[model samples]
Target: MGIEGLVAKGAGTRYVGGRRDWQKIRHRHSREIIVGGVLGPITRPDAVIAGQYDAGGNLIIVGRTGTLSPSQSAQLATLLSPAQAGHSWPDEISAYPWSGRDAARPLTKVEPNVVVEVAVDTATQGRQSRHLMRYLRIRPDLTPADVDQLQL
Candidate 1:
């Protein structure tokens, strides 16, 4: 017989809660993006934000890395330097079209010279990824231009 499953729910349930009410699970997808900058304080970064270059060569914000460990944060802090004047994507860090309360948080733009691979689950909306991404690792051998070769 074909596979089967059961979904238990309270009687008269009307979607009155969160994901706990759902019976289905979703899989995540992965991709590589250029590290455009880091968000939060330099001493302890909250997340690593990344982007991809479009056909027009514009560095478009793709997504931000998820919660990083202390060691990861410290290591990133050492590798990244504060973006100086005339930085590429000058307003990108502050002008990110964050939704809800996220817009209120500060973003520290860094040199967009690092490349990283990340695992993301959601679909892309406009130029941004729809979900928070997990940082898989840094691609020391890869350059920002290599992102175009990735299938996504």
Candidate 2:
């Protein structure tokens, strides 16, 4: 069965519910805001907000609403594929369903603790989206260089 199918079976009908609070901002890497792969003279996040999944089987990630340039849109697409690549943490933790989040409870903390690297065809100021976000669970034994070398 597909991963989604498995998650659905495990999740039943619970949703995490938290998509409307995300702070959206432009793509800010360092001090430069990139839009259409071009560096903007100023530096600032296009938008920022707190977002979470909804209660009705929909993952609603909301932030400041802004138009994404073609380049930015492309970059965003890459994130989707990675976002679906879910894994467990704690090494010994058994993969099990949770209240929400695909019915599979992520073993470690969802943010920071877990790092996902996604490939970007191009980036824009508001949101550099090319595809889907690829999920990458950090290995405690791996060095920074080891992780850096692997790009989405």
Candidate 3:
């Protein structure tokens, strides 16, 4: 079967039979995204600022990941480098996930070299994801080019 998975409703919710009601639970999906920047110091980024490339080779800012553990942050730091001159993205971006975005969180630019796999909600389209992406892992085998034109 092609079913992805089921979502658990919040606490204090009674099961109701279908009776003319409309509800949508955005399912999670894994996708490859380019690391356009970070939310903290490059040496130890708190989260990844995800992005994807357009047909013209320009990077588009997608959603970001949640805070990484010390080890997870260290693991990602090893593969990241500061963005070089003429980098596609700006030095910082205020963009945040639709659900949990902090007004004080910072965005630091990085070389779009690291490719990561993340789980995002289904409400997102190519431009960006509406929810915070759950970081899966670094994809050493795939390059940013491989994520080109991918739908969010």
Candidate 4:
């Protein structure tokens, strides 16, 4: 797993800023760690697992990885709550970069050079349901919008 590779290389911790910088890279490079490219689509028949930490240090576990039983899903949800509970910045990762409550919009823009796939377990629709819980990956090519179109 990417986390294992990062640890092997002596990377003690990773941040969302690392993700932003990786997106700007020309090609996927892994001197010390493997990284985001291995992760697959959220709706792929085969799944990928991933996690992200928001500013407050809340770890959000995401991606299908495989079919999750209800109990497992709940456990995962609990693990990810810190991110949800501690997100004070409305625009840290949201469609509205400035923040005005258009949560349905894509949080990160998928550049042509970078293909990042994001895996999400469920999507809820509502005024408050703006951002989707996602496990992001830097694939060859990917778009957050496609996740919304997945046939469940």
**Best model number under lDDT:** 3
Compare candidates 1 and 3 on lDDT and give the better one.
3
lDDT of 2 by residue, 38-116 (tens): 1111122121111222344222222122333445434433322222233221212211111113332222112212222
RMSD of each: 5.4, 19.8, 5.2, 18.1
Q: Against the true structure, what is each candidate's TM-score?
A: 0.73, 0.18, 0.77, 0.20
lDDT of 4 by residue, 36-123 (tens): 1112222221222223333444323222233343453443232221123333322223334123464542121111122234432222
Worst 10 residues of 2 by lDDT: 32-41
Badly placed stretches (over 4 Å) of model 1 are: 1-19, 88-102, 149-152
What order do candidates take by lDDT, descending?
3, 1, 4, 2
Model 4 bad stretches (over 4 Å): 1-113, 126-131, 141-152
Looking at candidate 4, what is the lDDT of residue 8? 23
Off by over 4 Å in 3: 1-25, 99-105, 150-152
- The per-residue C-alpha lDDT of model 4 at residue 145 equals 26
Clashes per candidate (backbone, < 3 Å): 0, 47, 0, 2
Decreasing TM-score order of the candidates:
3, 1, 4, 2
- Residue 2 CA error for candidate 1 (Å)? 24
* Candidate 2 wrong stretches, greater than 4 Å: 1-109, 135-152
